[model samples]
Target: MDHIFFFYFAAVIAGTSVLVVALRNPVYSALALLIMFFHVAGLYVTLHAEFLAAVQIVVYAGAILVLYLFVVMLLSIRSEERYHNQLPVAGLLGVTLCTEVLLLLIQSRTAPAVPRGSAEAAAETGNTEMIGEALYSTYLFPFEVASLILLVAMIGAIILAKKDIIETTE
Candidate 1:
């Protein structure tokens, strides 16, 4: 059943997400995050959002995770034995968030479901097309801003790397 698949994906995603944060080793944490990403893509597939599923796999799991691993390897970061003192604060926030989520879930279950659009309308428009339209239309300015920010970041990274290379050669 759809519910079974949803629950399975949700459970894996939740577990892996926790593992991603709790793991001491950066590589292991990234790997856990990779598993979480795959499960998220699976969740999207279960929701009939094939394009989103593919994008999630390709963008987050493939590109972003690869970038994270590269940074981890290049930096050669060592795991610190001492833990941060923020555990109590984090625990309090976590408990508060869990309670809020539970309340929201309960409220949603009791609320009447409102149909935003008919299945025929969605089917005719297609998920990809709808997303593309919204991205290029309603969210055009924000999208462009994000792209600009990425461009600046890329250029800055290149400059910094070049300086390091020059210094090492000297």
Candidate 2:
């Protein structure tokens, strides 16, 4: 039963990922990418990383995909009539991506899997306390800087999205 479920999920993930790059229409590609992200969250769930899976759905599927959809709708890009023989470029990019994925798979196959602490054990040990200790003791500056950068990016995006006004007065 678990084997079949895993196989089905892997198939869906692979299919949707390929469709995301193969579809000529931008909107269809975006939608396929949304599906691909959902499958990725499902894969995370299978690994027992519930928090990461929730973040994947909320950040990638909810926020990023919505941003892509907004841009697609705002541009009204329904067809490939504006593209200039980009199929070859797309094929090259696809080949490069496949090669990278192949390399990653080869590397992972040789690596031993690390056992994770059970969620119950982690909770009993104090999950929030452990996370806070790690972040503050080791990764404090990097985490703070990253948050600052994200804030700047959010402000920049809002500014760019605002409409421009032109005045003609004689």
Candidate 3:
């Protein structure tokens, strides 16, 4: 059943997201983040979002997760110094925001709207080829913008990895 699949995906996504937050080791956290992306891509597929799922896996899980792993590996220093994040105000603000969102969610549980699109759409135009056609034809500008963002991120990552040197003759 589609209902069962949705619940399965939602569970995986939520579980992986929580693991990403609770995992202390940077590498484990990155792995959890990748898992979260994968589960989210699965959810997109259930919703007839073929293009979104591809982008989620390719751009996020493939590119961004690799970048995060490289950063984590680079910062694998053996210093056991404990660091404290002194952000009491920011923490309180975040808690407050979460509580407000919880309240909003509870209030909306009484009357849920019918979901758009049918299961038929999920069967039709569900492959990478059709998704790419839609992206390049209908959403060309947004796709170009996303590519630009990825280009900038790649450049920034390279710059971050570069070592600066100074030479002097006395």
Q: Summing lDDT over every window of 10 consecutive residues in candidate 2, give the lowest-scoring window.
A: 161-170
lDDT of 2 by residue, 35-147 (tens): 88888888877765666778889999999999999999989876765546876898899899999999999999889998866678665655456667778989999999999
Question: 1-170, model 3: which lDDT tens digit per residue?
Answer: 99999999899888988787666677887898898899899999887677888889999999889978887788884432443475577679979999999999998898678787676764665577677788899999999999999899888866665666222221
How does candidate 1 score on lDDT?
Answer: 0.92
Judged by lDDT, which candidate is best? 1
TM-score head-to-head 1 vs 3, winner: 1
Evaluate model 2: give its lDDT.
Answer: 0.82
User: How high is each candidate's TM-score?
Assistant: 0.85, 0.71, 0.69
Model 1 residue pairs with clashes: none
Total backbone collisions, model 1: 0
Indicate which candidate wins on TM-score: 1
